[model samples]
Target: MMGSVAQLWRHPIKSHGREALEAVTLSVGQCMPLDRHWAVTHEASRFDGTGWVSCQNFMIGARTPGLAGLWARVDEEARRVTLTHRDLGELTFAPDDPAEAARFLDWIAPLCPENRARPSAVVSVQGRGMTDSDFPSISVMNLSSHRAVAQKLGRDIEPERWRGNIWLDGLGPWEEFEWIGKTIRIGSASLHVRKRITRCLHTAANPITGKRDTATLDALEVGWGHCDFGVYCEVIDGGDIRLGDKSEVL
Candidate 1:
């Protein structure tokens, strides 16, 4: 056992907010349930919803740092999400509903900059997540690696900054990078580690304050000579993955 599952998170609306999960069922060749299921496209976006599009077409934390502070709670069965931010108290809505989606855009307008393209619509691609990677992927992060980065920065860093799907504890610093191209089992699911997740400016924004308080990219470059902080994996075998489940390299 390399480590145990320490936390699970899903972002129902891409780059909008993150929600914590205690357990989730994984499907082969798919992203974590409801992760990035919906994305808000800007007025200038050419995303016709015919297929996956690039992140630049949407409103994201990298471009709009205030979005990092948003947190969410999803009711999967109801297909509804409730989002909360320090500036905006709370809003519960069905993202797929056109009327509600319009309201969402209005509510979130203040957080976005006027110079940037305005958020226009909520969109989703059937049977696929709008992940950063072209292929469906789940991100796995190591707690030890996060600690090492924190140590290098001489301050505590929140895991939310990484926006990872699963977090594992008990592995050595940078140990997960060695698992590339390998198979790993967590709970009853098996995943093939694909590649390193190169981070972006979004990670520099603090999730709590939604401010660019840390130089995460610089820290990683200075401490490790790379900006990667996690690994992306594709599920080869599907099953339930829960908090506290053992994670082993197979």
Candidate 2:
């Protein structure tokens, strides 16, 4: 039987930054620790007033080459975040400061010229108007499935391209699909495999360089007959998930 926890990932800011973890603990149905806990929204926006914005609206991609260089770090204990770009040093924010949200919006505006909203109108994912495109939460990737696509693409694909919250390394190729409708154990925690994650334009964007190259998606379609590259799971039993934790398909 395939076993072992292959990878762990968390996105501190929704659609803006990602962090890889050597270990993590999660609560039942909680989002991968701090993953997508924060998000950036348009200048003029209200979370519930407007529908959830699609990631395609803003993210490091063909539209914003500079976003690739954006690196963000969160000090959860301090309730603060720091974002860094090549030309700029570090810009910090207090998660609670009412003005902090607006500051973040201004920071992203110049870089995202495609957005017509004024620079000062920034909003957070937790703010009134923000929500992920679909699903209440997101997490993980199957390493074998990721590799299969790379093999078919005839290129080395970076995990950033898929932007999965967790990247599992030990499972069989396309094995995660089989995990659907089942519960798997990671450390003491258990997660129920919900369904497959279908591919989108984000897959075409190079996760590292944030360049638009559809080769990855093309490979998936021609080789696998589908664009899916990962699976989604909802936490069942909660516990610490560390690197190399045993994974048992139950």
Candidate 3:
């Protein structure tokens, strides 16, 4: 039973940072602005036709814990994106500006040692690296499921570990499971509740400081039998979703 949306978050750069918004309007055939639109990649790796590899396979949950702390704010009018961090000052760039990508490469290259030399890299199936998953640009999850998993683990699991594009509140733990294969209306956006999200080692990694926290996994194994935590969904009717949007199950 979907109840109400509790929170909405977006990560502009994959594995680097997240931007929490009070509300956002989405159009078809496009992802939320700055949501995984860019990523740093290595030519030596695959996920390209070269082979099966991805950013999550490397430093994502492994080396840089601070990567989780990156924050972004979008300037919708200016068509610009600003990334900020505690150690790094605010960097503002237009999403489509060629110079912006160059600046991004320069700014972030040294922050993580892996991209130090070849930091200007791009991941284009036609050009550099790979794009994000599926035609469904947005990802949604149920909060009740989160709490259920937390209870099962006997400890609190931070929402960041799931990295969902949206977090819905006011649901019972595992109540979302009932909505599977159903359409749900969240604010102005309608989504088809799809499947349960399975856990990866990334769940064991803290999204805040980026350190690997095995407690979530340990709890899951001892209790839930697996690290499964939340539900995954696709946006059907795109529109604005906010912190307190009604997430009614249909």
List model 3 lDDT by residue over 131-198, tens digit each: 23544446677777777767776778788777777787777766766778988787887777777666
lDDT of 1 at 90: 97
**Per-residue C-alpha lDDT of model 1 across residues 63-96, encoded as one tens digit per residue:** 9999999999999899999999998989999999
For candidate 1, the TM-score is: 0.99
Which window of 10 residues has the lowest lDDT sum in candidate 1?
A: 1-10
Tens digits of per-residue lDDT for model 2, 128-217: 222243644545578888788887777777777777766677678988888888888878888888878776665676555555765776
The lDDT ranking, best first, is: 1, 2, 3
- Candidate 2 global CA lDDT score: 0.66
Backbone collision count in every prediction? 0, 7, 7
TM-score of each: 0.99, 0.83, 0.77
**Where does model 3 exceed 4 Å of error?**
28-30, 45-59, 62-64, 110-132, 152-157
| Candidate closer to the true structure by lDDT (higher is better), 1 or 3 | 1
